[model samples]
Target chain A: MQQIDASAIDAVGIPRLLLMEHAGLAVVRAVHHLVPDPSAPLVICCGTGWNGGDGLAAARHLHERGHPLRVAVTGPLDRLREEPAAYARILRGLGVAPVECLTAEALGPLDEWLAECRLVIDALLGIGARGAVREPAASMIERINRSGKPVVAVDIPSGLDADTGRIQGVAVRATMTVTFGLAKRGCLLAEGPAHTGTLVVDPITIPRRLLETAAA
Target chain B: MSIHSSLRTPTGVTASLRNVLKRFERVRHLMTQGAWPEGRSVYGLPKIKQVKLKVRKAAAKEKEEAPAEAPATGAAPSSSSS
Candidate 1:
């Protein structure tokens, strides 16, 4: 899937940022479907990668649509990669400074914070993530699941393997998963169905032929 | 690869070969772009800059109004001391 995204960017000339935007929009739409109240508070938990980029982008859209929002990033703002960093910068420019919660100490207030949210966006991991989830992220996922709020996971649920549907230690039990492009094989097999309450396949701007090629 | 006579059932071999060819045909299309159509825009989003501006403006407005009010409440008590 990452290869297909790269091919779409390199061979098909689609900007990575545009794909992120589309992904974010798709998530916002799914959120709206689940939570119709415009003023309901939405918490988006982000990591440092492109999945976080999608959440940051969704935060902007949700904010625009009058949904109260808070962005809690797993690490320091400076640690974010390029595309996520760009969206985070823009979010800051809009005066929505994402809270950094990298340590257990920093995450101390998160459970209480999430308890009040109408919904949670789990942007902590994606298809590229592997192995067991480490600290702060692991703790954060625990907090999200415990909050008992409806969670909308971006791509696969943060801690589930995208190809095998195996849980990497603790995983977020999402109310819905807004996956990009095609649904991953993992989302359909094994523990995926139990963790992913609902699944949504959001379309990116990749050409159909490219996806067919990759699948073929 | 030579198939051993004992291992090959005539019908099974024909079916397996046909399936392999079908898969190869699909793979060939992916490897070579000659059969694919073109001219579609890969960037499908619209009014992105405008959306960003709106979000920024709204956030700035919220910041201005935040000072007059007590901190937004309803959050569970902080546990930072723990």
Candidate 2:
């Protein structure tokens, strides 16, 4: 599987956070459409990096809209790098106290949380994620998958590739995928469609003309 | 050209940008024209510089004054008004 670094986005000349906002809002809209109510109990699974930022943004936007949401940070929040950490702080400010359940023992509440929620968000392993899913994240993915609650995935299904639709170990099975900008070629392929449900492309503020120029 | 047909649209970072900005604009427009109809916005209502009318849904006008419709019906906002 080909790995993608979020820094490579710099070559596109667009702010990564802007992309995350677009991604988060789009996922929010999709989730709103699918769930019976905006306040329907939600369990958001998050990782570090931009994908986590995307999840955090969605949580912020949801909180801003008065949606009832609870975030489960599957990795150590300290494990997060720069930009994402800034966004994580925003989540805390909104009172969406994150459960840093990075291990199976710490994740005992996940099954309970999943059972109580109306929908689950797979912001766990984004496109930047590579290799097999470690402990808590993998187990979390399995629970979210097994729980049968509809999941809205940000970017590619966590653990799936952005270029190839290959999965490393366990990946979140999503009912709807709000992919940023364009539909990644991976989602159009086998493992992608299998993991990703109704694929929706929620491109950010970048100009269409700019994208066309890049293609040309 | 379709969702199932993997004809591979140039997901060049550029095309993705085009689609995203377009959606954001549409969302902003919907917010402005009052597509929610009930006017019960989720807050952070898309603003166009100092014009914030937080009308309750019961008070909202059904016909939102939309910008000129684009040829893209796929991106068109749905009307719940009968």
Candidate 3:
């Protein structure tokens, strides 16, 4: 999947930002399918990776559609990689600054935020995550699960082994998982099925022919 | 000549009828080609299509039997004192 994404960006010349935009738009569409209320309060939890980038972009889309939403980050904004950082900057420019929830105290208001929101978008981790989840992310996952609100996970749920379906220390139990490109093996295996309530295979901007080449 | 006689009534009606039939034929062709039948309105609303997915009964049963166990660490890590 990584190879295909790289090839689509490098060889196929599809911009990473455009791919992220499509992913985010697909996520927004999925959320609309579930919630259907544009006025409902929504919370999007993002990390420092591309998955978080998807959430950041989705936040912008949702905000544009007049949905009352807030973005919560599991880590410092400065730690975000290039693509995600660019999105974060865009969100900031739009006057939608994401709230950092790295510390336990920072997460104090999370419960209240979740209470007011209709659903949460979990963009905390993606297929790249392995080993046991660390620090603030693990705690954020716990809070989100306990919130009792429905969660829509981006790609594979955070802490889930994309191949083995193993839970590395912790994983979010999402009401729906919006995965891009193709379905991950983990989502259909072992504990993965339980955590991922309903799996949605959303398409990115990558050409079908380019994807087929990877399969070959 | 009388005004009624001057009007090309038969030709006008025949021409309109032909146009209507041509539109119907176009719609029939599209339907046969598996295109969604669009509504006559400007919105171009599509006909509702139903799609059903097969459920894996064994998988459903297994999911019910599965335990909701805590993570390996059991407890979340404490924050480092700022």
lDDT of 1 by residue, A1-216 (tens): 898899889988999999999999999999999999999998999988999999999998898888877899988899888889999998888878899987867887787779779999999999999899988899999999989999999998999998777899999999999988877766765587778878787767778987776555
For residue A86, model 3's alpha carbon misses the true position, in angstroms, by 1.8
Give the interface RMSD of candidate 3: 19.7
TM-score of chain B of 2: 0.20
State the weakest 10-residue window (summed lDDT) of model 2 chain B. Answer: B39-48
Better of 2 and 3 by TM-score: 3
Candidate 3 has which clashing residue pairs, if any?
none
Report clashes for each candidate as comma-separated counts: 0, 10, 0
If you assessed candidate 1 against the hidden native complex, which CAPRI class would it receive?
incorrect
In angstroms, give how far residue A66 of model 2 lies from its true place: 2.2
Report the lDDT of model 2 for residue B5.
57
Per TM-score, the best of the predicted structures is 1
Cα lDDT for residue A147, candidate 2? 98
Better of 1 and 2 by TM-score: 1
> Model 3: runs farther than 4 Å from truth?
A214-216, B1-82
**Clash-forming residue pairs, model 1:** none
Error at B57, model 2, angstroms: 56
Query: Compared with the true structure, what per-residue lDDT tens digits does model 2 show for residues A42-133?
Result: 98888876788889888888878777777988778887777677778888887777779868788888898899999998898777676788
